[model samples]
Target: MHLVDIHDEFTHFMANMTCLSVMSVRYSSRCILAKKLRDCDRYTNIINYFELMYCDLKVRNESKEIGVLCLFVLIYFLFFCVVFICINEYYLPALKIAAIRLKLNEYLAGVLLVGVANSTSDFMLNFSAVRSGSPTMNLAMSNALTSICVMGGTIYVIMPFKINSASVFRDFLFVIFLLQLIRFFIQTDSPTYWVKGLIILLIYPIYLAVNIIDFLLMRYNIRKLRREIEILRYKRSSPMLDKKLYDKVTTLKDLEVDDDFKILRMKTRYGIFRAGVFVTPKPLVEPRKVDVESNRVLFHNKNNPKNRFLFTEFIQDLNPIDPEHWMFSGKYGRAALICVSPAMFLLRLAIPMVNYEQIKHGWSKLLNCIQIITNPFLVAILLETAYFTTHNNSWLINIYFDKALWSLAVTVPLSLIVFVDTRTDIPPPYHKLFSIFTIVTVVTLIWICSWEMEVIISIIGSVFNQSSNYMTVTFNAFSNAVPDMIAYIQLSKNGYGKMAFGGIVGGIVFDITINLGAQFARSNSESRHLLGDFGETIYIFLLLTVFSTSWMCLVLDFNARRSGGIFLWCLYVMFFIYVTLIEANVIHDFTADTVIEVKD
Candidate 1:
């Protein structure tokens, strides 16, 4: 009994010892795992601390980075200005020449080339934005609005003089009305989408007509007012009135009276006259009434026939002495005639007493010369010649005390020759080379400009409340519109009236539709779609801006004219003011908060 009990106790003790060893192993492993987890957590905290410090350093340096970026952008903008001015000076004439060579019809060419040329910078910017997969549709739309509202408004505020006529408001109002229609078209899926485009296309011409009519009316009113004022002034200054008044004063003095009575009479007369000195009656000029007989021109030589081919007659008909004819038409005509005149002179030289074989040889040389001279350099030379012929009649310099003028006279032409690649002696082959160089330089400038804009845009997006949607409304819109407005001024001055109108209204139309047309078409093809929250806001703001701008352009009779410029500008200012207030939470656009649910 003692031996069995001892064995049982030994077995129980062995089991207990094994259990203790297992528990110790488990405890040690658990402790090691816990220690590793604690170390991992510590490393994570250290990494987080470093990350925070890095972020703080970046925040501290952000102002400097922005400052540097702003400096670069400013330099780029200056370059952009330089390039734009050069393009304006050189590119326009070059383009006109190019168009002439292409044989584009005058009116069509004006509408397409002149109008489109002005907005090339904007087109390039938008093209780049699209290629980079940014929201270009919104960018383009915003740019248009900014141009119309902000730029238009600024011009008005700066110059708030009264307009003689208010016809421009008609076109402006029409555009605003059209914009509302466009908004509806954009928002709803109607069968009339294509119809809307057609309407937009047609509406621009009507807008142009309205502007032209208004301009003419303004000119008419100004002339009428001037004539009225002139008539009033003439009446006031007429010798007849002075003579009558002089007679009246003399008669009053000559009247018979005793000394005391005369004195009293003079005093009474003087009192009556004293009132006239302080407040005279307004001149009552008889209004010129129209008579049928008076209006008719009674020709002294109605049946006389004039010689058509006499040099004097031709000169008179051509109006060669007229400054306008000489400066514009004559200059262009002379340049064009140079090309033909050379060949004609060459032919005449050979034509006199020449054998057939010799004539053939002469003709071949003439053809070669013609080909050689038909280069862009020739155009440049022609321009220089025209400039010299008209402008050089009077010297820019004087012999005495005019060193600055002398230097200007000397250096300006030289600079033009070098920078513009204009030459009289440059040969045909070299002309082509110069043309290529010019073209390349222009393209390079444009490329650099676009790149700078993109970079600046990116910087702007990062630094401020850089939402693409809002930025489109503010900066992008303003930037794009500048080119169009500038182009309009240039083209209009050149008498390309249709072209100028097309560039502005056409740009707005194209930006609103075509830029996003592809996207919308594709999306609609796939399924029904709506813009996200940001896009919707942009569209709404755009609509509101257009409506306000249009309203500003309207007169009491709802006509458009330059007078609306001030009001248009005010609308733009109000828009920005409201936006600022809303942003600062002094106000809010509650529409932004409302969401409409659509059921599929």
Candidate 2:
């Protein structure tokens, strides 16, 4: 053979060998992958099963069909009713029972549990979003604030009743304060003091007390007016009297009488007389005058310098302590308390939970066994604060807002949520009832919660994927907010309008403080970074919230006109524009892309 022909034949042989090697490697890799899949078949099967289940359980049977869509629409309504009834019957009662078992006072428990339940949906969504590697911290926080705004708008639009109660303002102020306080805490890189968390926790009890007191005061005033009306009618029945006699008897009604007092006589020439109203023939005992010159004991002489002073008796009465001694001594408990109470308060506020219960007993043992398990980090925070404050240069009380000490402020509460057994220490009968109740609540809540989110992501997400802002408004907003809306409507219907309003405020507060707090703890650094990036957007929403709430209160002074609702609706529109154009930064400006590009 010729040398050129031999070289060409050798080249073709090499190419064929290379192709064979490639085929062998590819087949070998496929065999390995198949072996691995067979070994992890359980996980694959589980995932596949859940996928099938989800597809089967969708609310919409066919997304494109009109008739199917109508059928699903009706089914959605039915589903909503079932969930509502489940919540009303099972969920609330379960919470109430759990709270009672937990020994939380009625109003406090109501605020905590009801607020938690209403905002649970938001918490779950935020958790899943972050865990799924989505940028959701800003979305989560803004969604919470926006929920408050939506709630206020809905209240105005539907209820149209004046919230003319001190309780309403009080709740609003408290929520505002809480939001601001949390914002301040998160601003600093310094470690937060667990004591500050304790202080925030303390606000709930005080809030509950204030609500109860306001309710009692309102009821008392109503009862008192009714009594006065009844008495006035009897007064009118009396025969016409001389103006002097009428004045005398009018003054008689003003007498501060105890329950011992009784109406002995009515409408005689002598006029009305009740026991203890008039003191008859009692000998007067005038206060002894101090002898300033002699510096000795004195008697009932009004001419003495101390006695002659214009407001001498008033001054004596006004003395917070024992005026007789003019010092802290016996009978000076009130004075001592007044003087030292603030110091004591500061002490409690700074004390660590470690110092609280080394050995938990009785009620604390029963309810807050979880709470007693103190985190070392929290104790260190308390100690740091104590040391810093007690040092000679301790004028940095204001630094509490600006600086942080080491803290398990979030961790401790998060643990309580996970580990604290609600059924712990209950007796047999109640324990069984609680178990059954809790199981039902858990199951029902789980089912509804999953369904709601699934519907939103699948149905609403598919529809509005092009515009995230639309998805938020049309579905995300309504899905999370509907629970609160239902709560408000039911509360109003049941004549607990103030409480209904309070529930909304309470729900927002709970979500922000406890629910959001826990999520932040779990993903603290990421949350902080996200907040830093999106702080402005959050503040804008917050400002809108303040304005909306203030406007609602102002408009409430008049009728809650449809105009007010329209204004709120406009405000929400502005909010969406701000979120989309400014915060989300989907659009650079108002002008068209072409115009912006030309300008550039």
Compare the candidates by TM-score and give the number of the best one: 2
For model 2, residues 154-264, the per-residue Cα lDDT tens digits are 544443343543445666687777667666655555454454455555666666667666545544554665566556655635455345445544544432111011111
What is the clash count of model 2?
A: 2
The lowest-lDDT stretch of 10 consecutive residues in candidate 1 is 257-266
Query: Relative to the true structure, how large is the alpha-carbon lDDT of every model?
Result: 0.40, 0.43
Best by lDDT: 2
RMSD to truth, every model: 27.0, 25.5
> For model 1, how does the per-residue alpha-carbon lDDT over 391-470 read when each residue is reduced to its tens digit?
11121111222222344454445434443432122122223223233333344344434544544554455455455444
What's the CA error at residue 2 for candidate 1, in Å? 66
Off by over 4 Å in 1: 1-60, 94-111, 119-124, 127-137, 151-448, 488-502, 522-563, 590-592, 595-600
TM-score for every candidate vs. truth?
0.43, 0.46
Query: Model 1 misses residue 201 by how many Å?
Result: 9.2
